[model samples]
Target: MTTVAILDYGMGNLRSVAKAIEHVAPGHEVFVTSDPARVAAAERVVFPGQGAMPDCMRELDARGLRPAVMQAAASKPFLGICIGQQMLFDHSAEGDVPGLGILRGEVVRFPDAAMQGADGLRLKVPHMGWNEVWQRQPHPMWDGIPDGERFYFVHSYFVAPADDDIVAAQTDYGLRFTSAVARANIFAAQFHPEKSAAAGLRLLANFIRWQP
Candidate 1:
């Protein structure tokens, strides 16, 4: 069975993400850990996070888990969710913060207030709720998932990768932005698959079964 480690940096919805993975891969071992040793030993790693980019970086650094996470992504299958996805990049404008630099590019705020619609009007930050993902490339990470499938999202900033080839899926808020990305053994989603219902489960299942 695959052993998956959920990096616990004290800022993510760790339990929910872990529960979703456990529901899909009952036979696989899923551990929520802050220990670098366990993360290094795991076959796969899931990095889930919420809140500002700077705080997330600080917590990861504080726990001394940043290097371990970077190593895992470089050598094994790594799945990043929400802020976890943003951190894989070079930086984020959310808090004028630097990211883990696993992937090139930076996270920026949604452009054009009107693009988010009138209900979301005046709200310059925190793009929340369910949104559909537009798949761009065929990848194992998104296998069995349909195009234009809606997923839960709750963030103001989004990843803008330097390389377009790594973008596997996109979603439109103010504009079309990178929602899912993949390169080698590393895959990430800006939306919360754990909160996206059946579509989310399918994604988790795919990740569990995916061979690097």
Candidate 2:
């Protein structure tokens, strides 16, 4: 049986991610694992995270899971959620932390200058709630999901990939930002599919069927 590993390095809602994956892809086994060997051996990888970057990095390093994560990021079908997506970049301003450098961008906080809408309305930092994700390019993970699908998002910072072509979807809170990015064998998003409704489920299903 194919196995998908949800990396468990003590940071975000791990079980929710696991359950969502299990619910959508029942044929595959989902394991919420912290063991390096398990993560290294999984057929596919889901790196999910929440919380501060410094702490997330610290925990990942402490658990000796960084090597495993790097290996998986290079060779497997990987899905990164929320902070998990942020950690793929080369750096993050959240705590002046360095990421895995798998992606060519920097994860940054929403600019204070761009924090307010054109109408002079100030937006919150975490950018919480449901927002429409505008599809920027065609991809397998976006299969069945509409061109402008709304997904549940709760994030303060977002990725700014150096390359624009890799952006799969865009969303606007106070300002437009990359909501999802796809390249090679990876599909990452700043939203929580587990918290999203029908569209989210469909995305998970598409991910299950995704050959990449």
Candidate 3:
């Protein structure tokens, strides 16, 4: 049976991510683990997170899971969620922190002035609630999900990849931003698939059967 490890670096909603994966892949072994060995052993690795970039980066290293995470991202089907997605980039505007650098990019906060609708109404910073995610490219993770499907989001910052070719999806709050990225075996989303209801669950299910 396939084994999936959810990297528990003390920042993300580990249980929720695990439960979602479990719900989709009932026969697979899903572990919420801090053990580097287990992470390296798993056939699939999930990196999920929330909170400040600095703290997330610190906690990941404090637990000595950085190398394992990088290794998993390199050779396995890796998934990152929310802060998990931001942490994949080179740096973050939040706390001026550097990320895992697994992907070449920077996490940037949504500008305050740009936080307005075309109608002239102000939008919130966090960009909370459901918003349409436009599929930028064809990907396995987008299987069975509509192109303009809405996903749950609760983040102030979004990734700006150095290479646009890596971007899998985009969403607009006040302005368009990279909401999801995919390259090789790595797929990460700025939105929470766990909390996104039907479409979200579909995404998790897709990840279970994804070969890349």
Candidate whose lDDT is highest: 3
- Across residues 61-114, which tens digit of lDDT does each residue of candidate 2 receive? 999999998899889889999999999999999999999899999998986665
lDDT of each: 0.91, 0.90, 0.93
- Candidate 3 least-lDDT 10 residues: 111-120
TM-score of model 2 vs. true structure: 0.96
lDDT of 1 by residue, 1-212 (tens): 99999999999998899999999998899999999999999999999999888999999999999899989999998999999999999988888888888899989988645665547655455778988899999898777888999999898889999999999999877678899999999999999999999999999999998888
lDDT of 3 by residue, 133-204 (tens): 999999999999999999999989999999999999999788899999999999999999999998999999
Candidates ranked, most accurate by TM-score first: 3, 2, 1
Pairs clashing within candidate 1: none
Candidate 1 Cα deviation (angstroms), residue 146: 1.0
Q: Candidate 1 has what TM-score?
A: 0.94
Counting clashing residue pairs in each candidate, in order, gives 0, 0, 0
